[model samples]
Target: MRSALIAGTLLLAIIATIFFDEVRSLECYVCSRQEGNAEKCLTTTKTCESDENACQSEIRWGSTPYWSQGAEKQYYVTKKCAKKEDCEEYVNRFTSSCQRIWYEDWKCGECCQGDRCNYYIIMGAGNLKATWLLSLVTAVVIFRHIFAS
Candidate 1:
């Protein structure tokens, strides 16, 4: 009975470590962006004039939704441009479908700012740390069971 208990504990510890390790390594792509300046207004083939001077924008990372306790949180990353070419390049990086703002068009919200991107990375790292700690605890438990038994 003692041996069985020890073996069970060891197995549980190993499973916990694997679970936490997998969670720690989970790559949840949040968002990233490159910033620049604008210089001129470029017209698309659709007759839409994307002002080059209007600031370049890039969605370094796309938006993702997080849900908790009946609340939903959205996250994304965006880069702003200071020159016309910069803004144009930022806009051009996406497909024509992503350029639209209204219905049927995708638009990035305020949460998609550069500062938020930093926050996302920080939070992601915290999650990773938590997972790592869980794995470490599991490893310690397993080691204790193996040698102390």
Candidate 2:
């Protein structure tokens, strides 16, 4: 009877791990159209949706408006988490020369895999956490089974 209970508990734990993966989220910088003179953007973290797995950044440059007398150029930057399909589509669309309109100039976009890649913060420790958790869970189950038997 005790063994059955232990087995059931282990099964539940495994099921929980699988279910958790479906709801797993990635952290991303979510901002657009921010204005600042600083080259690095001040960012806020967001929990990305399940479909959004890639980090993305965009930079755009535009000619000065005719109404403006200043010789300054216009620039915009954005960062966010994006869906893989959308990222591919964006690459296909923007890989060529930047689009130009009467007043608008060319824009550049980039996509990267892994967490916070768009921000250039590279660390694989987060991925190891799940492995650690599963290992701990497995060890616990084995220990419990040995003692219970």
Candidate 3:
């Protein structure tokens, strides 16, 4: 019984370590339009208007407006590009350039330039750590039970 208890405690400790280690945050780039006109494209003032009803809505998630702040009123839009390569591709594909900015945690930032800019934010960590830790603990428990007996 003492041996079993010790083994279980060790197993739990190991599982906990792995669980914490695997619980890393993941960042994704988000862009949004600033609350100003085109002439002030250099301004970095913007805010994310979250709509619980439209969390999954496919509307513009970034600050780039549909219409240009310039003549002809052509609209410029922002898209979420996870990878740097993807961001570059977006700029190239859309015939528009973008400034990439890094953001920590899950908080959103305002637009920086051209009524829009790239910002990074945490999306979700999921159950990866828990799953890994559980598997490890189960394996350790089985090994100890079989070998000790």
Best by lDDT: 2
Instruction: By TM-score, rank the candidates, best first.
Output: 2, 1, 3
Q: Which candidate has the top score in TM-score? A: 2
Cα RMSD for predicted model 3 = 13.1
Residue 115 alpha-carbon offset, candidate 2, angstroms: 1.6
Tens-place lDDT per residue, model 2, 14-42, is 76875665457876666675442134444
Residues 83-141 of candidate 1: C-alpha lDDT, one tens digit per residue: 34553454455555354333232543211111112122212213134545566777777
lDDT head-to-head 2 vs 3, winner: 2
| True-structure lDDT of candidate 3 | 0.35
Q: What TM-score would each prediction reach against the true structure?
A: 0.27, 0.54, 0.24
Q: Which stretches of candidate 2 lie over 4 Å from their true place?
A: 1-23, 36-40, 64-70, 98-104, 120-149
Judging by lDDT, tell me the better candidate of 1 and 3: 1
What residue runs in model 1 are displaced by over 4 Å at the alpha carbon? 1-4, 9-13, 16-76, 79-129
Report how far residue 46 has shifted in candidate 2, in Å: 0.9
CA error at residue 21 for candidate 3, angstroms: 1.8
lDDT of every model, 2 decimals = 0.37, 0.63, 0.35
